[model samples]
Target: MSHAPQAILARPALLFLVLVMASACASRPGTDTLIPFGATVPGAKLVKLLVATNRSGHEGHSAGSASTRGELRFEELTVSIPPQHQPGEIEWSKTTVRDPLESFVVVERQPMNATDFQERLNSRSNGAGSTGIFVHGYNYNYTESVFRLAQLAADSGSLDVPILFSWPSDGAVAGYVADRDAATYARDDLVTLLETVGSAQTRRRRLLVAHSLGGWLVMEALRQLRLKGRDHTISKFEVALAAPDIDVDVFRKQLEVVGKLNPPLAVLVSTDDRALGVSRRLAGGRQRVGAVDISDPALREAAAKADVRIIDISSVTAADGARHNRFVQFVALQATTVVQADAVTSLQKAGAFVFNAAGNVVSSPFDLASRALSSQ
Candidate 1:
C-alpha cells in the first residue's frame, strides 16, 4: 500500500483546482464602489479645468477639481459623458485588462477660472522653484492624461511644481488628424494658460513638457507667447518637447521665432516610438524631427544655429516599457525632475540663457550638464 505516492499525486491536482477557483473568485466584479475625489490631505487645492470641449462644445460639459494633496481613487472603470451632459457618476468595478493596456481615473474633476490656476502654480515652490506644465500626446483621454500626470509627478519626486493641462483629445489612432484639429482649436486655451502662468511675478521660472502632438501645441503656444512677450516686459518660458509629431522645417521655424524671447527649450526624442515611426513613414519615410539618432546634418546644422538641446532618450526605459512616454516613464521623470530642479536653482541664483544642438535654451549654468561635466 503505497499511500504516500497517491497523496503526493493528489496534492498537485488539489493545488491546481484551488488556484483556478481562487482566480475565478477574484475575477468577480464589485457592484458598488465610489471613487473619491478632492483633497486626500486637508487644505489642498484641486486643479481647475478651464476649458472642457468634447464632441459638442459646451453642450457636453464636465468639470471637477482637486489639489496635489490627495489620493485619487479609481475602481478600474471608464467615465463617459452622457449625451444629455448629465452629472456622470464614478463607480467601482473589477476590470480585466491585457498587459500593456492603458487605464485612466479622475482624482479631481472641476474646471476653474484662469487667474486662480495661475496663482496656484506660483505658490507651489514659493515662487522660487521651477514650475512644470505637462501637455500629453495623442490617443489619450482626459482621465488618462490626469492619471499619467499624477504618475509622472509621483515618480519625479522632486517636481514639487507640476501642472497637468489636458486638452480635448479624440483618443484614437485614426483620430490623429482630428486631434490635430482639436489642438489647433484649443490653441487659444493653451496660450491663455501659458500667459497666465508666465505673467506670474511670484514664480518667474517655468518649463513646459509636451509629448507627441502635444509638442506642437506647446510650440505653438510658446510661439504665441513669444510674439506677445517681445513687445512688452514679458520673459520667455522654458519648454521641453518629447517625441513631437511636427515637421522638421516647421519646428525649426518655430524655434527661430521663439528663440527671440530667450526661453530655454529642450527636445527629448527616441528612435523606438512606433507611433512617431509610423507617422514618419506616412510623411514619406523621412526620419522624424524628434528622432535625435538619425544624425541629420541639416537638423544638426539647425541645432547648431538655433542652439537647441537635443537629448537622445532612445536608450532610456522604465518598468512599463521604453521611456517612449517621457512623462509616465520613471527614468524620464527623473531626468525631467533634474532639469526642473536645476531650473529652479538657476532662477534662485539668476542664471542666463544657454543653448544646445537642438535649439533648446538652458537658462541656468547650474542646470547645464556641460557645466556640471566641466566642473567634474
Candidate 2:
C-alpha cells in the first residue's frame, strides 16, 4: 500500500488503535466497565429513541430471569461530543470532530416502560412516520448499544426514530457462547417489536439494522416470522446486515428462506473484517458469511437469487484500520473530500445496486462519497 504523508502518520496509530478499539482483551483481563448512562454533551442535539433490551439494566451485563422482551427504555442521547478512539471509553462533551473521525457522544438517558414508549411513539411519529431499529451484536452493553443507535440516527439525517434492541451480552470474549444463547432466547422479543412497529402505522418506512451476531438474531426472528405467516409485518422494513458473524453456509440457507422478502434485505459486507477472522476459527473452520467475498461465483449467485443486495465494502477504510464494522463512520471512499459527510443516508439513498466488475454491489465509492458530501 502506498503511504501518503497523512497515511504514514495515521496508519501505524490505527494499527494499534484497532486493537485497542475493538478487542475485548485490552482492558482489565475480563471485566466490562459500566460507563454511567445519561452523560450528555452540551449544545448537541438530543436524540430520542426507543430501547429494547433483555439484559438487567442495573449494570454488570446481567440478564434478568424474565427473558420476554425484558424491558424497554426511552433514551435521549447527545452526539456533539468527540470520539472515544480507545475502547471502553465514553466521552460526552460539546466538542465536534473537525477531523471527521469521531464517535457519537451519548449525553443523557431516561428509562421508561413499553406503555409509555408506545404512547410517545404514537404521538411523536405522527409527524414523520419513520423509525430505524438497530440490533446490536456481541460484546456490547446497554450504554454502547443505545449510543451507537443515536449516533447513526443523528448522522443519517433521515431517521425520525432510532430504536435499539439490545440483547443480553456479558461483554466478555469468554461469554461468546452465552451471548449466542441469549440472542436466541431473545428472538421472541425482537419479533414482538417487529409486530408492534409493523402495525404501528399504516404508512411509514422501517429500517432494521443488525450487526455481527445480532445479524443472526435478526435472521432467526425473520425466519420465525415467516413460519408464523407474520412476514407481512415486515412489509415496511428495509433490513441491512453489517459484518454478520453467521456461518456462511448457514447464512445461505437463511437467505434461501428470508429471500421471501427480497429488496427488503440488504447486506453491508467487508472482505477484510479482522474480528470475523476470529469467529471463523471458533466456528470450527467455517467461514462467517460477512467475511466472504461476493465475487465468488457461488456466493454471487446466492446473493442474486435471494435478491439480497450486497454492498461490498471490501475497500472501505476507517480511522480504526477498517477492522470490524464500518456502519457508523463517515464513508469518504478515500481521503479526498469525496464522501465528506453524513454517509448513512447516502448509503440508504444509494439503496441496493448490482455487483460490479469488482463484485461490489453498491455505488462506486468515489461517486457515493462525492454525492454524499455534495448534498450537505
Candidate 3:
C-alpha cells in the first residue's frame, strides 16, 4: 500500500495548523490606519494612480469584505511617500494619525466614472510612455493594494501611469480560501479593465503585472479573451507574474490558451518562497510555477517552447520573511538606471535567467552548472 496519498492529505492539514499558529503570533496593523490623512510634507514624493476595484465601499473607503454591486468602480488616488522611505518597505504608522514625513499617506482621492477613467488613462498614454496595471495578490485590502502600487511606481520611476486593479481580499491570514474565491469572482471584471485599456486609441505600451493569486486571475482573464477570439487584446500588453501561486500543471494549461504573446510573459520566480511552499502543500503537493527549479532543463525547454521567460530571483533577499516579495526589491534595484539597463539587455530573449543579489542577470543553467562543477 502506498503512503503517498496519506502523506499528501496530512501535509495540508499540518500546514494549516502551522499557519494558524503563526497568524496568532503575528502583529497586524489596524484597519483605521488605512484612512487617508490628506496631508503633504516637504521632500516627500507623490505617486498618482488610477484605481479600479470590485470592492464595496463602506464609510467612503473600499471595504475588503464585499464587492462593488457586482461591478467595477473607478477612482484616482495620490499617495505621498515619506522622504525617509526605504525601498522594498511599506512604512505604516504605529499610531492612528499617520505622519506624512514618516509614513505613506494618501493625500488626494477622486471618484471617477468609467468614461472619465478611460479618458484620463488615454491622456496619460498619449505620449511615448507606458502604462502599468498592477493586480495585488491575496490577503490585501483596497488601501494596501493602492499603496503598494504607489510604492512600486515611486520606486521604479518607470511608469507614466500606474493603475491598481484591486480585487476584494479579506485581508486576514485565515481568510485564504475567501481571498481565492474573490480572486476568481473578479476575473470577468479584470477582463473588462484589460479591454478598456486595449481599446484606447493611443499607441503607448501596456504592462500588466500580477502577484501571487493575482497571477491566476490575470491568466484566467487572458484565457477568456483568447477563447472569445480577442487575441489582439491580449497581445496589446506585456505581461509579468511575480511570485505566482499557481500550480504548475494549471499554469501549463493556462499558457496553452494564452498562446504566444508578442513580448512573451516574464515570470519572476524564487525557489525559496515560503508562501508558495505553503501553497504547494495545500495543493496536494503539486509544484507551483513560481517555486519551480528554473535550472532544470525540462523547465527551460518548456518555457522556451511556450514563449515564456523564467527569471529566478532566489539569490535576492526578500524584505518579507516569506521570501515571496523579492519582486519589490527587484523593482527597487531597477531604480538605479545602470542596473535597469543591464538587466533589460540580458533578459531580451525568452528562456531561464537568474537575477543575482548584485542586480546582475546571468544565464540560469550556466550559472548553476558552473557552481556545481566548482564545488565538485
Per-residue lDDT, model 2, residue 18, is 41
lDDT (CA) per prediction: 0.48, 0.59, 0.77
Best by TM-score: 3
lDDT of 3 by residue, 2-53 (tens): 8864564366554564465355326555555545678889999998899888
Judge candidate 2 against the unseen true structure and give its global Cα lDDT, from 0 to 1: 0.59
Q: Per the 3 Å backbone cut-off, how many clashing residue pairs does candidate 3 have?
A: 0
Sorted by TM-score (best first), the order is 3, 2, 1
Query: TM-scores of the models, in the given order?
Result: 0.62, 0.71, 0.87
- In terms of lDDT, the poorest run of 10 residues in model 2 is 27-36
Local accuracy of candidate 1 as per-residue lDDT tens digits, 80-99: 21122111111222363211
Query: Which ten residues in a row are the worst by lDDT in model 3?
Result: 364-373
State each candidate's clash count: 22, 6, 0
**290-355, model 2: which lDDT tens digit per residue?**
778766877766666566656766555443443675654422222222332334343434333333
